[model samples]
Target chain A: MTAVAGVAMANEPISPIAPVKEINLAQVELGKKLYFDPRLSKSGFISCNSCHNLSMGGTDNLKTSIGHNWQQGPINAPTVLNSSMNLAQFWDGRAADLKEQAGGPIANPGEMASTHTLAIDVIKSIPQYVVEFKQVFGDSEINIDRVTEAIAEFEKTLITPNSRFDQWLLGDKDAITATELEGYQLFKTSGCVACHNGPAVGGSSFQKMGVVEPYKATSPAEGLAAVTGKDADRFMFKVPTLRNVEMTYPYFHDGEAETLTEAVDIMGRLQLGKKFTDEENAKIVAFLKTLTGDQPSFLMPILPPSTDSTPRPQPFD
Target chain B: MTAVAGVAMANEPISPIAPVKEINLAQVELGKKLYFDPRLSKSGFISCNSCHNLSMGGTDNLKTSIGHNWQQGPINAPTVLNSSMNLAQFWDGRAADLKEQAGGPIANPGEMASTHTLAIDVIKSIPQYVVEFKQVFGDSEINIDRVTEAIAEFEKTLITPNSRFDQWLLGDKDAITATELEGYQLFKTSGCVACHNGPAVGGSSFQKMGVVEPYKATSPAEGLAAVTGKDADRFMFKVPTLRNVEMTYPYFHDGEAETLTEAVDIMGRLQLGKKFTDEENAKIVAFLKTLTGDQPSFLMPILPPSTDSTPRPQPFD
Candidate 1:
C-alpha cells in the first residue's frame, strides 16, 4: 500500500475503500447468475439488477424505482455499491445485513412480488441451477436462506475501489484538483464528515435527516421510526455512503434533491444550519465527482433456459 | 476444422458457425455501453438488453415483449444472437441490417419511446459519452447513424460458436448423442434442411411460414407483404436462425409455439404437410438442444452517468 502523509492517517475518521481480494469463485458465479435472472420475479421481468443496476453505478438512476406493475417506490432506491460497509441495509436499517435485506424485495407486493417459496421453486426447477446449488452448498435442497446468502456474498464484491480521492488519500498529492482539495477541506470543517465518515463515507451510523431544523418533503417515510415504531427514531435514516455519490444521484432518502449542488445546499441548511456560497457548492460537487471508482468487471452470466416442467412466468395473469 | 464422413463436406447443406475473427475494439466497447445503457429509453429503464437480453438467450423470454408503458408488442422479439448472419433484419426484413434495426425500437412508441432527437440530446449532454464518442468516431459530432453503426459493430461479435452439433459435424463423432444423430439424419431426409441451412441453420433466406397449409396465429403482421406490398409475400418471413434454439423458446414469428416439440410439430404440419410421431419429435428436440453453442462472453460495460444537464427521464409522463 502507498503511504500517505495527512490522509488515511491513524486518527483519520474515514478510511480508504478496499478492493475485494478473495472470495469463493463458485458461489460468486452462482450468485451473479441469480442476480441477473429475472424469473425470480412474478412477472419474469425484474431482476436484482433492474433496480440496483451495475451498469449505472449500482442504481436504476430513477428518483424512485418503478417496481411491480409500475408502482413507484416510496423512497429512493439506495445504491448496492459498497453497501456491506453500512451499519445495516436500507435507509431505516431494518434488515441487519445484506443477507436479510436480499429477501425483502422479492416478496414485497410492490417490488418483485414473488413469494420465497415460488422463488426457490423457480431456481430448483432449473437443472443447471440445481446442479450449481448442490455444488455450492453440498446439497440439492434449495431454500430462501441459502439463496439470499449467495446473493449477499456477491453483493460484497460490488465495492468500488481506486477512486481519485482514494489515490489522493494514499499519498498521491496530484490526484485531486485544487478545487476538489478545497472542497474536501470545507466538507470536513463544516461538520459534514462527522456522520459521513468511514471507508464508505457515510454508512457508519444512523443520523436524523434534519438535525438543526426540520426537513420538508412530500415523502411519507418515517425512516427508522418505521422499523422501531419509536417516536424518537422519526426521520432517522442510515447516512448513505458518499462514494460514487455523483452517479447515484437524485440524492437523499426521498430523492428530492436532483443535483449534487442542491443536495449540498439542503444538507447545509437542514443538518448543519449553515449556508454555503455557490462557489463552495460547485467545488463540493466537483469533489464528489472524483469519488467514482473502478466499477466491478465480469462477463455477463448466461442464464439457463427454463424447462417445460418449470413454472412459466405469468406476465399478464 | 475436422473432417467428417458426410457432414460439413463441400456438398453438405449445413455449415459450421464461426467465431468472430475481427472487430474494432473501441467501437465494440462503446457500443456495448450504449446497448446496456437504459438512459437511452424514455423511462431510463429500458435498453437494447431489456428485450434482447444477453443473459436469457438474447431474448426477453416473453411471448411478446413488454414495452414502454407496459404495452405488449405486436410480434415476438427475435434473438440478437448471430443476427448479423441473417439476409436482413427483423422477421419481415423491413430493416436492411442490424444498424437500421438498432434505431427502430428506440423511437417506437410501444418500445423505448424516445425520439432520435431526444436520444441524441441525452447522449450529447453526458460529458463522458461525448468524450468517448469523439474518441471512437474521431469527431465531436454525435448522431443516430454513428450511434447505430457502433451498436451494429458490437452485435456482429455476438456469434455463438462451438456447439455440440458443430463439433459432431467437425468429425467429433462422440460430441452428440446417438438420438441427436438419428434426429439430424431425419431432419435432412424430411426436407427440414431446405430453409434451415447454412452456418446459422436458417437465416440464409426468406420462406413462407406455412408452405403447404395455412398457419393459425393471432399476430397481425403480414411478414414481407408489408415491405413489398405484394399479396404473394403475405406469409413470407425471414427464416430465423436455429442456433441456440433451445434457449430461444416460445418459438415461431408470433411466439405461439411455447416449446421446441410444439414448434417442430407445427412446422411439420404447416410447412412439410407431414406429421411427426412423438418419438421423432423428442429426437428432433434433442438435436435442437445440441445447437446451443458457447454463448458470447464479455465483461458487462459500466455506463457513464447522466449529467445534471441531461434531460431527465419522464417515466410516468
Candidate 2:
C-alpha cells in the first residue's frame, strides 16, 4: 500500500465503521431484486451475486472467477462486502463509482457477457421490473443508468459494521486478545497502517502492489497502468477493504497467496522492506482476523418470473 | 397429474394446502445452507438454487435448466416449493424422496457434476459445517446420508401454503373471480382434475406423457422407462405438481411449451383427445396464476469460508 490520502497519521487514522441510518428503502429493495436477478446476463445464470456472492464474504471464493461460458477471469475478483468505501472500482481503478462498476460486468465478455441493450431489453420485458423501476425512479422507463443506480444503491447498504476491532475502538477492553492487540501495534509500527488506514481499513487510495520490491504478479492485469497508460501507474491498484477479510481468502489481486500467513509475509517483504518472524506474522494475522465484521443479513429476494415476451437466455451460445 | 391417490375426490377433490406445523428446524436450517451451497458441485458455481431457483417460483424459469459447463438439462425443472407434497421426486419418479433426489444432482454429469464423496469432503473441510453437522445429527461426522437428510428436512419445509386458490377452497367467496371460478369448474368437469387433484394439484401418480396421441419430446430422456427397463413404462413420468405452475414455465418433461396456455392446449390434444378453446385456455391460465403462493422468505445464510485443505473447484477441468 503506497498512495496514502484522505486520512493522514492523525490521532485516529482508522475510524470505527459507522452504522448506516438513512437509505431509500424502496430503491434498496428494488436494487436487491435486481442484484440477485441473473436475467440481467445473456446467460441468465450469472447474476451480480455470481462473482460478488453474499454468502462467502461477498466474493465467489474463487482465486479468479469463472465467468460466462466458463471463461476464467484474469484477476481475483474483489469482495463487494465494503466495496463502496473503495476510491475506485476494479483492479485497474477504471470505474470511478459503484454505479459505473455495476454496468461493466454485465457487458464484460469475460464476465456476465451481456450488452447494455440486451440487459435493458431483458429487464424491461419483465412487467414487474418495469413497475419497480417506475416506483423507484418515478418513471416507467427502464434504462442502463437507472439499473446501475439501483444496483449501486443496494451495494451502498452492504457496509459491514461492528467487528470486534470496532468494539475495541469504542473502548470495550476485552474486545480483542492480548496477542491481537500486540499484532495491531506491530501493524501500525511496521508502517502497514500508512496505506491500510480508513473506516474501510484500506480502500481510500490506489497503491502500488509491491511498494518496496517488485511483485511477481501471477495475473496479466497491469492495474492502474491499464487505465492511465503510464509506466509509473503500473502495478497500482485500489487497496481492497480488509473488512471480513477472513472470509475472503486466496489473498491479493492475483490470488497467489492462499493463506493469511503467506499474504502477511509477502506484504512485509515486498511492501515494507521488512522480514517478520513467524510469531510476528501470526500476530498480525490474528489482528487481521478481528476485522471480520457482522455480515449483512437480508432475505433472499424473490425475483419475478420471465414472461413469454422476455428474450430467452442463450447460455450455450 | 395422473394416477391420483390419497385423495378420493369424493367430497372435495382439490383440498386447501394445509399449513405446515412440524419440521426439524435445525436440520431444515442446515439443509437450507447446503441447498444454496455451490461447493457441492465441481465448478463451485451451480447450487441447487440454480435450477430450482426459489426467486422465480422455485424454478429457473428456463425451459430446461442450464447445467454443469452449461450443459442443457433434459427436462423442465420442477418447483421445489411444495415439492414435499409430491409422491415421488424427479420427472420420471426415479428418486423416491427428496433425500434421494438431492443426491442425484450432485453426481449428475449434466447437473452439478460432483460425486457424493467429493461433496462430503468439501463439506467436512469447512469447520463451521462440521460443527453444524454435529449439532443437527448429534455427531461430528459428515456423510452423504446426513447431508441428504438435512436437505430433505429443509425440502419438507418448502411447502408453500396460502395461495388465493387455497383461500377460495377455505370458503373465501371473493378469493377468486367469476372467470377463475368458471375455469376451476371446467378444470374438474373436463377431467383435468382427474390427474391434477390433491393439495398439490398434481403429483401422487405416474402418467404417460401422451395418453391419446404421441408427443414429440425435445430431449432424449426416456422417462420412467429408463429406470424400469419396461416397454410398458415408456414415457410414464411422474405428474408434476401444478403448484406455482405459473412460474415453472416451458411445461412438461420436454420443456417445449413456452406458455401455460400452450401447455394446457397440448395436454388437451395429446392426453385427453380434446382441443381447448382460446377462452378456456385463458381461463385455466388465470386460475393457475391463483396458485402462486407465498414463497419461502428466509435470510440468506452466510456460508463458512473454505480453508486451504478444501479441494478447489475445477470449472474448466
Candidate 3:
C-alpha cells in the first residue's frame, strides 16, 4: 500500500473535498469547444452534448443513451455535471479518471464509434480548432491524451455546487421550504440513507436495485452484469447523485418512470420495502423540485463541423 | 404628397435622420426566441438562424438559403447582423419595413412556409411557449401582427454599430489599420461611393448592378425583375451593407462569387469598368475585415423548461 502512495487515496480520498490541480484555462476552453463539436462522432451528428446536455440536467431525457448508430445503451445517460467529484467513473466504476472516461465514447461501437486517428484528423481540420489546439497544447503534439485532458478540465468546471441543498447544508435555513425539510427527515427515517447520504447525495456508493422486493428488471440492459459478468451483480448499478434529479427523467437505470412521483414509489417499494401514500409521494416530488437549481445561459460550444448533416442512424449504421 | 397631418419630416425636420420607434425589449426577447425556434418551420427543423446564423457571420455558409422541401432560393441569404438599418427589405426591396419583412418569410412557399394562423397554433401547442407569449403580449392574443411586431423589435436589436468605420468617424486614429484607411480613400474616390455610402454603408440606397457597364443578363437572379416584372427594374437591386460583410461571404445578390477577392474583381470589371490589381484587392479586403465588430450573444427570450427531455415534436404527425 505504501508503494502505491497516491493509489490508496485514489479510491477513497481523504475527504470528499477535492484535491486542487492547477488547471490550464487554455485546455478548458478547447475542451469547451470540443464538447460542443459534433464532428467527434462517426455520423457527425452525435455531439457529447447530445447525451450529456448541460441545458437538460446534463443528461438527455432518454431511457437509454442514443448514440451515432441510434443504438441505445443499456444504462441511462449519466449527468456530466459534477462528474468530476466521482471517485471512480461510469455506473460500474470502469474508468479510474476523467481522462479514461473521455476516450470511452469516441471508440464505443454504439456511441461516437470514431477511431483515435480519425477523431484527431477531424478536429485538426477546423481552422478554429487548429488555432486553439496550438495555443492549448503548445509544443506538445495534439493527440488523444491532450483531447482527454482538455475534456477533463472542462468537466471539472461543470461543478454545480450552489444548489438549495448545498445552501441548506451551509446553514441557510430558509434555502429549503418546510415541506422539503420534512421530506428530508422522512428520507433519513425511511432508511434511504443506506446508500444515498453524501455531498453528492448518492454517487459515493453503489447498491443493488432489488434489495428487498424484486426490481422486476424490464430494461434490455443487464445493468451491472455487463461490467461484472456476475449473475449476483445482474441488478446492481451505480447509485446516481440526486443533485438535479428532478430535471433528469425518466428515472432509474432505465428511464422507465416519467415523473419523480412514480420513481419515488418504486424506490420505496423496492429499495426500502415501504409503501407510500399518494400525498407522501406528492411531498417527495415537491422536495425533488427544490433540488433543481437555476442554470446559467449555456454558450453552446460553437457547433463543430460535421461530416454529415443528418439525423443519427441506429443499429450500427 | 402633403396628405398626412402629423408627418412633419416630409416638410423639413431639423435632423435628416428619421425618428425610428424604440424597440421593446420584452417583444424583442419574444421575437428572438421565435426567430431561433425551429418549430416555426414545417419540418420543425429550420429557424431564422438556420440561414442567418450568427457564428458563421450572420449568414449560413451555403451558396443559397435552403428551405422546406429542400428548395433553394435564387438570392443569397443576407446577414441579419445589422439588417435593421436597411431603408427597405430584401434584395428586391419588396417589403417596406421589418414587420413586413418578418411576415414575408413565414408565408413564403419556399421559406418557413407557414400561415400566421398555423404559426401561432404551433407556438401555442408548447405549454412553455404559451406561457412566454402570455407574459410578453399581456393576453393580447397571439396573432401574425404580434409575431411581426415582436420580430421587428428583435431585428432592431441586431444593429451592428461601432465598427472600425464608426470608430474612425468618431476621430479614433488607430481604429482602422493604415492599409484599410488607404482602401477607404480609394473606395470613396473610385466612384463606388455614388450609391454605397450611408449609415449602414450601403443599406440606405438601391442601385443598378454594373451601372457604368450595361447591366449583365447572365446572373442566376434577374435582381428586382421578379418583384416588379418591369424590364428596367431587371438588374436593379438594393446595395447590401458592408457592416459585417467580411463574415457574410459569397457576396452579391446571387452569391455568384465564392470569395471577396473574386467578388472585388467582378465588381471592378462589371460595375466600375476598371480592374483591381492583386495589391488593390488585398487592401479592399483588409478594409472590409475592419468593418467587422463584436457580435453580442442574442439572448433568447423564452427558455426551454428545466426538464432534460425536449418536448417531443408533434407538428406534422
Candidate 4:
C-alpha cells in the first residue's frame, strides 16, 4: 500500500466541479421555454420552475412542495442544480435518467396532474409551439418523448461549477480557509465520505437513511422498497448531492431538519453513530457553505401566446 | 374658423408610442428580483409575474387570475406593458400610480394574501435582501413603502416600444399596409380615438363601457363605482392600452370577448352604437396586431436564500 500511495494519478478527481460544457443551443432553448411554460400542467399555474426554481438553488424551499390542488408532495424536493450527476432520478432511484423523471411529475396526481395526451394536445394547439417543435425535431408532431428530451437537455446545463472547495481541489491554495481544510480532513476521515464522495458529493449510489440508529421519519415514504418491492431495500434512498447544500435548505428526504447544523447533527447520529462537537459542526457547516458556486443564468423565456384553439386551463373544478 | 384651424401645434402629440426611456438600474434590478420572487405571497408560490407575466404580453391570458387559495379574481388583469402611461391603476383606477398599485395585491385577501408586516419580516430575515434594500434606499430599513417604490420603478421599464405601428408613426410610411392605414383613419373618424388615443393608444382616462348603448356583462364588477361609491361612476373603467393587444386575450375588463374581432365588434356596437362590417372589423383587428412590440428581456434574477429567521409560508389555513 505504501509503494503506490505517493504516485499521482493521470486522471483528475471528478469531485472538483467543471465549468459549463458543450450543449445544443436549439434544444436547450426549446427546453427552457417548456421548463417555464405552465400550460403543460392541468392547473396551468405550476411550471417546472415552480418546484425546481432556478432562482433559489433550484428548489421551492418548502419542507415539502405545494403541488396541484395544494396537495403536499410525498417527499422533500431534491435540488435540480447539478442533478445530472445523479446515478438515477428521484429519491427512490426509480427513473433511469432526467428524461424519465421529467415525464413523471407532469402527470403525477399530486404534482402537475396532467396526462401526457392533454399536455401534448395543449402544445400541439399552440401554433408557435408547433413551429418550434418542427424546428427542433424536424417534424410537426409534438409528443411527450420530444418534450421530455428537450427539458432534459435544458436540465443538463443547470450545473453549478467553480465552488471554493472545487477551486481548492483544482490547485488553488487560497480558495478554502484553514478551518475549512480541517473540516474537509474530518469529512474524509469520518464515515460520511463513504457514500458521499463523487463530483456531487453524494448521489453516486443509494444508501440506507440510518445505519447505526433507526430514523423515525414523519413522512410515510418507503423509499427503495416502493420501487424494488424488496424488504432489504426499505429505507434505502438516494443520497442527495451536497453541492450548493447551503442554499437548498430543509434537508433530507423528510425535510424534518431546518438548518445545515441540525441536518449535520441528525445525519451523524442516525447514519454514523457519532456525536460531533459544536466547533466541529460549525467548521463542517462553513465548509459546506463554500460549495455554493456560480448559479445558472439565463433570460426568463418568453412563452408563446395561446391561440383560439388552445385548450383553456382547468385550474379549478 | 379657417384662420385658427390652420395653425400648427407646438406641443407634440402623445398618441404615437415611443422607445423605452431612462430607468434606475439598481432599483429596477432589486424590483425585478422581488417581481419574480414568490415569497411576497402567503403561499410562497405566486409573484407579480404570476398574473402580470411579461412573457405573454404582460398578462396571464386567463379570463381572470387564479389567486390566493385558488380564489378567482373579480376583474380581468390589465397588461403591465406601457402601464406607466395610465392616468391611474387597476380597472377601476383606484390606486393613484404604479407605486400605490404595487402594495395592494400583496396584502389583498384574494391575491397574494400576505400582510405588509409578514412580507417585510420575510424580506428582512434574508441578509442579502437587507443589503439590497440598503443599497437602494440609502438605509437598512426594508418596508412596504420601499418595496412598492422599487417594484414601481421596475414596472416602469415594462414598456413595449418599436412596434410596426410605432415605426409607421415615426415616419416609416412603408411599415404598415394599406388596410392598416384605412383602419387608423376609421379609428380617428369614428370617434374611437377620443378615448383610445395616446402613446399607449388608451389608458389616458376613465371611460364608460357603454357610452351610447346599455351593455350587459356577465362579470359582477361595478368598475369605477366600487372605488368612488357613486352611482354615476358605474361601468366607468380606465381604457386599457391597446399595445400588444393581440397577445392580451379575453379582452376588456369583463374578459368576455375571446377574440379581437369579437372585442372590436362589441366595442363598436356598445360604445359607439355602430355596426361594423366584417371587413371593417378585420382591418381594425389587423391594425391592432401591429401594436405587438419588443418584449422586455433580461436574465431571471436569482433570489436570496431564506434563513432560519425567515417566516415560513402558510399556503393553507
Candidate 5:
C-alpha cells in the first residue's frame, strides 16, 4: 500500500487529509463515559484510562506494557497523544484507524483482554449505556464496531491542536520566546524538519532512529525489524509527535532516555549526523515545553442507580 | 471516633462535615487533566477512567479488577459512581477517606502500583503540573496528600443526586411512573429499606447478601469476610448505592446476577426471607428503573498530545 504523506515529506505530495466528521456532543459524552468505564475490560479493573492516564503523558513510562496476566508486553506503550493523525496504528501500523485500534486491546488477552461480545453485553446490561448507544449509533445491533466507533468518536475529540507552536505557525511571533524561536530555527537547520514537521509534527512519518549510526539491536528491542523483519528495517519505528514533547519523558521507543535533552542529543548523533551544544539542547527543551497546550480534564460522573437490577453480564467469573 | 449518621455522618458534629472545602476550579481542572492523563499508569495504556469509567456506571463491571500486570484482582470492581459518599474506601473498608483511597490503587501492587513519591516526582517534573499544583493547593507542599486532595475535590463534583426519586422527594410527583410508586412501597414494606434506603440509598450501610439463607460462594467471591475475617461478615458486603443501579449490573458483590429479576429473586430468598411473587418482583424491578436518572453525556476530547511521564510504581515485578 502506498504511504500517505499528509504531514511528512513536502515532495511526497500531501494527500488530501481525511476529513474527520465532527463528533456529536451526545456521542462524545457517551464515548467519554465509555472511555472511563471499566466494564470494558475482562477483569473490570483495567480501563482505557488506567494506562492512558490523563495526569501523565498519554503514554505510560514503562519500557513495555503489562497486561491481564502481568505478562510483559513486547514493546513500549505508544502515546495516545495526537494518535488520530497517524495513518496507521501501533509501531507495526497494524490497525488502519483509531476505531480498529480500539478493538485490539479489548481482546488482546492482555491489556483489557475484553471481547467485543462481552463489551457490548456489558454496555447493554447498563440501561444507561444501552440507551446512549442506541441514541448515538441508532437501534442498530450493538457490536465491537459501534463500541470502537463511539470510543473513536470520543478519542477523536482528544485533540491537542493549537499549541504555542501552532500559534507561532499562525504568525504569533510573541507566542514563543526568543530562545525557543532560535531553537526552532536550529531544529530546521539541523534537518529535524525533514521528517518532524507537520500538523502533528512527527506522526506523519516513519524513520530509522539511527540513520547516521546504526542502532544496536537488543534482545527485546527489535524495533521495525519486529514489524517487517526486513534487515534494512532494523531500528525503525513510527516517529512520535513532539507536540507536547516537554510532558513526554524517558524518551525513545524503549523509554531509555530519561529526559528530552538526552533524547535530543542522542538523535543528533544518530538521526541528524550532528551534535547539539548544551545550550542548544537546553533551548530546544525550553521551546518544547512551550508546545504544551490546554486540555480538558477528566469529567467525573453523577451516576444514579438503576431503580432495579437490570440485565447485565456477570461481573465475576 | 463516633460514626455519624446520614450526610451528618461525614462530618464531625463539632466540625460541620469537616467543613468541606471548595475545590479550586483551577486545581480541579488540573486534576481533571491528570485524570485523563495516561502517564500515571506504568504502561501508559490505562488511566483513571479505565476502571472508574463515567459511561458504564463508573465501573468496569468485572467481578475482579485488572491492573498494570494484567492480573485479575480478588474482588468485584466497585463504582466510583458516587464513591465520595462512601464512609471508607474499598469493599473491605480499608481506607478511611477519599484522600487515603486515592493513593491506594496507584500504589497497590495489584492496581496502578505507582509509588506515591514517584508519582509526585513524576508530576513535579512536568512544569505545567507543578504550576497547576502551586496554584491549586496554594504552595501547600506538592505531595501525595495534595494530589489526592485535588483529585478528591474533582471527585466530589461527581454527585448523582438528581434521580427521579430525588426530584420526587423534592416534590415532583409526576417524575415517576405508577409502577415505580408501587415498587417504592414494596421496597419499604419488603424490608429492603431497612438498609437500602437513604439519601444515597444502600451506601449508608453494610449488609449480608444472604441474610436469612446461606448462599454458595463463586470464584473470588469472598465478600467483606476477606477484609474483616469475621464469621458474621462472611457474606456481608458494602450496601452499594442503587442510585445508578440500572447502568451498573452483573448484580451483587460478585456480579453473579445477569438480570435484575435473578438478582431480585436471589435477594428475596437470601436477604428478605421469602420468595418474591412474580408480580411483586416485577413491581420492585419497575421501581428500580425509576431510580435511573438523567446523566449528561461528555464532549469527546479532540485528540491532543498528552504530557505526563514520570516513573510510577510498576504493577508487575
Candidate 6:
C-alpha cells in the first residue's frame, strides 16, 4: 500500500503503529478517571499511573516498582504504550489480555495492595462514579470486570504513532540519520528481527532470555514455566516491545541493564551470540532511539469527589 | 459589576473568585510537565501530583497523606485548587508563599524524601529538561528555585472559579437555592464569616482551632505553634479555603471530621460555642456544596524521556 508520502511500499515485516481513530469516548473518559484515581489503592496514594506513567513512556522508569507499604516489586514495569499489540500480557504471558493484566496490580500484595471487594466498594460508594458507570455501562452496576474493561479500552488508545522510524518506512529517507539507517540494516541482517518483528517490534511471541548462554538473574520468577507448569518454559518470557524503548529504560524483566548500550551488549552476547563492535552497537542504539514517537495528548481527567456514603480510603490502616 | 442573570448587586463580604486570565504559557507548560514527572521523587514513584492530585479535588482524598516509605503524614494535605489565594502556605503558615511551600514536601523525610541537591541533579542530567528550562527561564541553569517557581506559577492557574455560589454573589438570584441562601445567612450570623471571608471564602487569616471550647483530636500537631516558638500560636491554623469544600472532604487540619456536616458541627461547638440543629447543619452543608466550582482543565503534559546521561532513579537503593 502507498503511504502518506506516496512512496512505493514493499512487504515489510514491521507494520506502522496506527493511531486510535474511533472508540467509545464515554468509556475511554471513565477509564481515564479510574486510571488516575489513587483511591483504588489501599494506601490511597498509588494509582495505575504511578507505575505505568503516561508522562514517562508509560513506565515509572524504576528498576523495580515501589508499591504499597513501600514493598519492592519483583520485576520491572513494562511500558503500557502499544501494549495491546502484545500476544499476551506481562513478561511471563500469565494474563490472557490487557483486561486481565489490569486486575493483577490492584490485587497483588506487593502492588496496589487492595482487595477486589474494597476496590469495588470504593467506586460504588462514590455517587459520581456510580452515575458515570451507569452512563457507560447502561446500568449502575460497578464491578471489577467493568472497571478493568474500561481501563483496558483506555490503554488501547495509548498507541504512540508516527515515529521517525515509521516515517522512514513510509519512504522518507531523510526521516532518520545515516547512522540510524545503518543500525536498522544491521538489526535486520544480524537476525535480531526473527523474534522482534511485528507492529510493536517485539511481543509477538515468548522467547528464551538467553538462547546461547544461561541467563542469571536475582529474581525468583520462573517466567512462563510458572504458568504452564512446563520445565521447558523456564526462562521464557514474552519479548517486550521495542517501541519507545529509549524512554522505558533499565531494560529487561530483572532490570539489570541500566543503559541501552549495556542492554544491547548483553543481548548481543547472550541472545545473538555475536560480539558486535562498539560502532555497530552505537548504530543499533541510534536506530532504537528513532522508535520514540508521538505520545498521547489529552486533558487530564477530573475525578468525581467521594461522598459521605463512599468508603473512605484506609491510608494508614 | 453587573453579573449574568441580572439581579440587584451589593457589596458582598466575600468576593467571587476570578479565573486566571494572564499567564506565561511556556513556563506554565514546562511546570505542568514537572508537576506530573515522578522522577523528582527519590523513589521515582511519587510526584507532587501524588499528594496534590489534579483528579480528586487536587488531593489524595485520605485523612492524612501517604508519603515516602509509606509513612503516614501528620496532617491532612490541603487542596491545591485556589491555594495561591492563601495569605501564606501550609496549615502553620510556615512557608511565605506557594514557591516555598512547593519545596517542603520534596525534602521532607515523611514526604517525597528527595533532597534539593538530588532533585536538581536529576533535572540537570536530563537533556530535555535542560532545553525546556532554558526555553522558560532564558538560561540552562536548573535549580530548586526555578523548579518551585514554575510549579507555583502553574499552580496559580489551578484556581477554580465560577461556582454557583460565586454566581449568586455576582447577582444571579437563581444561582443558589432558598435553603442554601438561608444557610449562607446563618453562616454569616454565626462567627464563621469572620474567618472565612475573602475571594477564596477563607485563607484570609489564622484562627485558633478551639476558641471558646477545647477540641480533642488524636493528632499531635500544634499548628502555628510548631512554626513559631510562642505557645500562644498553639492550634492557630491558617483558615482553609471554603471554595470546593464539597470535594475536599475529611475537613480540618487534623482531618478528624470525615464529612462537611461533622466539620460544621465541630466548628460550631469548639469555635463559636454554639451547636446547630440538624436542619441548620444540613442547610449549611448544602450551601457548602455550591462552592464546588469549575476545576482546571488542561492537557496532561507529556514529559521528555531521560537520556543516557541522566542519573538513574534509586527506587531500591
Candidate achieving the largest DockQ: 6
* Model 1 misplacement above 4 A: A1-8, B1-7
* lDDT of candidate 3 over A83-115, digit per residue (tens): 776766788777877888988898787787777
Model 2 misplaced regions, further than 4 Å? A1-10, B1-10
Error of 3 at B18 (Å): 13
Between candidates 1 and 2, the one scoring higher on TM-score is: 1
| lDDT tens digits by residue: candidate 6, B1-317 | 46442333345667888768778888888888888877788878788898888887887777888878788899999999999999999999999999999999989988888999998988988888899999999988899999999998899999988899988888777899999999998898987889998888899899999899988879998989999889999999999999999888889988889999999999999999999999999998988899999999998888887777777776666
Per-model TM-score, in order, reads 0.97, 0.95, 0.70, 0.94, 0.79, 0.97
Residue-level lDDT of model 5, residues B159-209, one tens digit each, is 665577655554566877888889878887888878776555666667776
Report the lDDT tens digits of candidate 3 across residue range B263-284: 7778878889889889988888
Model 2: per-residue Cα lDDT at residue A210: 88
Q: How well is candidate 2 docked (DockQ)?
A: 0.70
Model 1: colliding residue pairs: none
Candidate 3 at residue B151, lDDT? 80
Q: For model 3, what TM-score does chain A reach?
A: 0.85
Model-by-model lDDT, in order?
0.89, 0.87, 0.68, 0.86, 0.66, 0.88
Please write out the lDDT profile of model 5 over residues A1-317, one tens digit for every residue: 02322122333211122234766877777776677665577655556765564444565556666665555766667777667988677776767788898888888875777788787767666666677778887784678878788777777766565677655554455788899978877877788878776666677766887799876545366556776779887766778877666656657777667677888899888998888999998887777777666554555444333323322322234
What residue pairs are clashing in model 2?
Answer: B1-B195
Error of 6 at B119 (Å): 1.1
User: What is the per-residue lDDT of model 2 for residues A43-100, given as tens digits with 9 covering 90 to 100?
Assistant: 8889999888898899987788988887889998899988888889887889999999
lDDT of 1 by residue, B1-317 (tens): 44444545556677778767778889999999899988789998999999999998899988888888777788889999999999999999999999999999999999999999999999999998899999999989999998999999999999998999888877787999999989988888888999999999998888998888999768998999999999999989999999999898789889998889999999998999989999998998899899999898999998888878999988888
Ranking by DockQ: 6, 1, 2, 4, 5, 3
Model 3 alpha-carbon miss at residue B31, Å: 4.8
Docking class of 5: acceptable
- Shift in Å, residue A296, candidate 6: 1.0
Residue-level lDDT for A14 in candidate 6: 70
Error of 6 at B183 (Å): 1.4
DockQ of 1: 0.79
lDDT of 3: 0.68
